[model samples]
Target: MSETDRPRPRRRRPFRKAVGLAVLLAVIGYFLVQRASNSGPAYCTASATGAGTAGAGTVQTYEMTHEQAANAATIAAVGISKGLPDRAVTIALATAMQESALRNLDHGDRDSLGLFQQRPSQGWGTPQQIMDPVYSAGIFYDRLAEIKGYTRLPLTVAAQKVQLSGFPQAYAKHEPDAAVLTAAFGENGIPASLACSGPAPAAGDPEKVRAELARAFGKEAREALGAGRAGAAAGRSKPAGTVSEAEVGLRLKEGGGPAEARRGRAMAHWAVARSKELGIVRVSYDGSSWVAGRDGGAWRGKGGEGGRKGGAGDPHDAAPGEVRIFVARATAH
Candidate 1:
């Protein structure tokens, strides 16, 4: 073909540029979706023995939101602090699950309220007191304790005597899920065994964390939390150049003993469950650590522990039974 008659080469540069731009936008959109997914609702699960039942055996998981897990944890913790056995914690958890699905609701069937749906007219307590998970749990445990050989009684029988729910058999179904949670939030549960896919909080309050800890776990928790604050004050791990004023170092104990170690695990899991509400950014106990927004706050080894220069303190730097909790402090305006 003559040179003049030859068709000019189609301009591919603009086409290529447009394609590249579209690809870039798609990539950005993918990341945005991923970020949104990561920050979505908080979820926790445990494998029940017979598939979604607590114990040991099957791979089935019982799932619940951060709120439910927190309530259930509190129920179990109260029972434990009162020197009740694991069985007691399990019964309480299952009963709470059946009555309120582990929620601290302000209302229920026929003036019922709170975790166990205790009614005001029934002499359980006033509506205000019933709404308090701690009080409700304590009262429930008290009633459960009164049942002669309650632990030896059938799960439904035990819970029914205390709850007196119309659907006493309902407690049977939650037993598996309760068992899973009991195994996790209970002292017998593994360290960092439970996880919640909560996004990093906008800000955190160290004081609130301490108050909640004291409220849930009582005096020992308060003392251990104080020790952690002291450590942060004395220049523990952080992101360099910045102070750890917003960090809390809860030394579960000076060293590991069986009770202390188990307690540490329970405390660590509690922080994880309450991470969403407490503005917890990270939780570290023993050689493992969990950072909010990372793999849904899944526990990871100390590989990320190094090179932490101190802005918030390295969570993995916990000594012995220590648990480090970090909050995203509000930046000075």
Candidate 2:
């Protein structure tokens, strides 16, 4: 065949194949990103101010991931266990907000890790210990308590004494947000002020919730709720209208007076704050109730009598004595 007339061998379109492969990979990447974004825990924001009443000051709110909210709850719980006042919690939270943004990070300057960014080399704790939100929070409080006048000191000064950060002033800006969180978490006696908005967490185990409660609030709180009890006396209590030990919840005694009532409210708010993480569905204290995945997800009136004796028909109407926490079953979530 003449050169011009010769049939050219069919060329393989390698470029086309490469383009097809690239497009396929791009589609897969996009879907993976979307799935990851959707499957992770939902973001929640809460706030409280003034008397934590409807007309409270400016009503400042703060936004954070569910993880941050949960950690904030633990911090508040631990501080309360140590008998630290609300001011102490406000300072601790503001410091954490400044140090780690309320996230338990595994990295920071010069071996700093976890919330508050304490350095192991400086006696914060072992890396693993520091990474634990509870331990780290305890350590933070332990040091704060050592400060001669942490409670009366300015927030910045109190936080600076514990954190010793180069940017001491940074903690001040977070004070407002910290205050809101502290109040919502019951540091200032405002139960049900904090509410989370999202799909309820995967069904949570009440046993696991009990263990976590013990870890955060101390063993006495869990024991008081009849956790790990076996005999008739184990879970059974004589409190009027309170849930029995066999029930899948905790009923804190309100008869202990105002101090005890305040403690009950603190625990109740902590449970609500951690509902997303612990699979908690409802928390009732004083005369209010918070239900996850209900009524656009906010605290609402239970509308009955207040106290343990209140009928189930009006869970919110219970009087101000004990707090009740309900965890959703695995299948329920």
Candidate 3:
């Protein structure tokens, strides 16, 4: 009886091992599926078809959207950062990073718009204007900058000053998230290829716009930069209308000089500042366009001014995007 019972007991051991192995394999399979299905929010992973691929040089679709949000965050942060104490950038980034995750959302606690969730009803601006990421961010910074001793103030108080939310303390909860977004979005923090889906400018006919940009950039400016594409339909006309430093940067980044890029950034900021007053619809420089697209919301342009296909005379003025910075300097001068 003892031998029979002992002999029979051995069968359960192998069965138990097999069951354990199956469970282990299943667990590994589950995690593998999860990783393949979705890359975490902090960063998006590339797919087999290379969808949403963002890296230092790549600008994936998600990264681009995130970059747009980051740019909006930077716009707001830089506005508040000027002449303010060190913590101002931190507080501003933190607030925006948390609120809209720097995405300039259309909806919020109640009819809020853009990065800071500024309410049109509160006299911030019109819905269309407030929804403009740069404009909304500018307004937020303007108000925040006006707050005396804001840097010394508690984070909650500083944010409340600009936001005036019903729950003043709520901004504190966002501080951590804001930090993460800030780090992720900061200069080269995320990959250059990190991109998101947004509105693209008019695609059909660029000839008229290019001609305008070429006319605006001036022959001397075009020659100095070695711009190609002398007779393309969308040559240089479009960029001339509103050349932001970004347009300049596109040219420089493509191989424009240091003087060009520096001047370009200064102008882009200046042009963006004057967006409301000028009735200016678009500003392009540095291979990018900040203007109204067929769909809307921070549309960027391509080719045209950033390229060098124009004629020898270089009939464009100010290199298109230099106006914004040039104007600021002019005012100060």
Candidate 4:
């Protein structure tokens, strides 16, 4: 066979090696694109202008995942329902930030679980109960209330009293984030302060809203709504069921006092925080409004009546005592 004859022993091995390398590179590129596409935004930020009422002030902001933000809101709601002040909320938030970074984990160090990293063996709850954020938060507060002036203690000290973390000092570093979350989620912190970014969740179920309200507030919510209706009837006559189909109205007891207003705001914010999960589109109370996927998810003054312009004149405005929630129509899906 001549040097160039005998079919050159074929270039098959080199061609196959090149093909394999190209395939490997293509696979790597595909995975890289997939990772980029699947990864969500690194963080979500929420901000509020005024401290509480319907006025403008320096904007206070906090950044976290939607899950973290939602969990923070739940923790705050649980505290407020118990009449625990913002201080208590701050302490709880700080502890959670240190323990589980505000995530409701199914597993943790040993048997610890949920937001507070509570231990089942340590008597926090069963593994299942500790994994429920609301139940865990309630028990955390129950212990905190026994701390004898927990509100007066330093942030780390108070959180340590509840968490009993070996590294108690670690909580202090989270105090700033915890305070920001408390201010955004607490009743007295601000109205419409917590705003989320990204596409809104599916339309919320009205029945679910009612159930969650009752679950979070218990008898207080039902009693307040009834008292509010009675007061409204006594004050002046209005047509029944005047609210639009898209709206769900919850009236706070007219004479239920400041606590009622506080509860109202707490529920309003709760609905807003869980808006994506619950499919709530708009939440309005005390003349301020928050609409999902609007104004960067921040609260704005109710234009005309509804959060949107030219609606049935703001169901909330007509019944100032109520917290009005607007959900997307099923057909709109």
Q: Which candidate leads in TM-score? A: 1
How does each model score on TM-score?
0.78, 0.74, 0.42, 0.74
Ranking of all candidate structures by their lDDT, best first: 1, 2, 4, 3
**Candidate 2 stretches greater than 4 Å from native:** 1-41, 51-57, 189-192, 227-247, 303-320, 330-333
Candidate 1 on 1-333: residue-level lDDT in tens?
889999899889999999999999999988756644675556765533432332344554667888987887788667766767778888999888888888898888889989998999999998988898988999999999999999888899999998777788988987767767776765554322677775676666888887887887787787787776442333344564432436777876665466666567778888888888878777777777777777545676665432233324443456666877776665443
Could you tell me which residue pairs clash in candidate 4? 51-189, 51-190, 204-279, 305-313, 305-314, 306-314
lDDT of 1 at 307: 28
Query: Of the pair 1 and 3, which is ahead by lDDT?
Result: 1
Instruction: Give the range where candidate 2 is weakest over 10 consecutive residues by summed lDDT.
Output: 227-236
- In angstroms, the error of model 3 at 236 is 21
User: How far out, in Å, is residue 267 in model 4?
Assistant: 1.1
Q: Taking the tens digit of each residue's C-alpha lDDT, what string does model 2 give over 124-209?
A: 88999999999999999999999998788889998888888999998888887888877776654453366666665666667777
- lDDT by residue for model 4 over 66-182, one digit each (tens)? 788778878888888888888888889889888888889888788889999999889888988888888999999999999998888898898888888889899988776676677
Cα RMSD to the true fold for all candidates: 8.8, 10.5, 13.3, 9.7
What shift in Å separates residue 173 of candidate 3 from its native position after superposition? Answer: 4.8
How does model 3 score by TM-score? 0.42
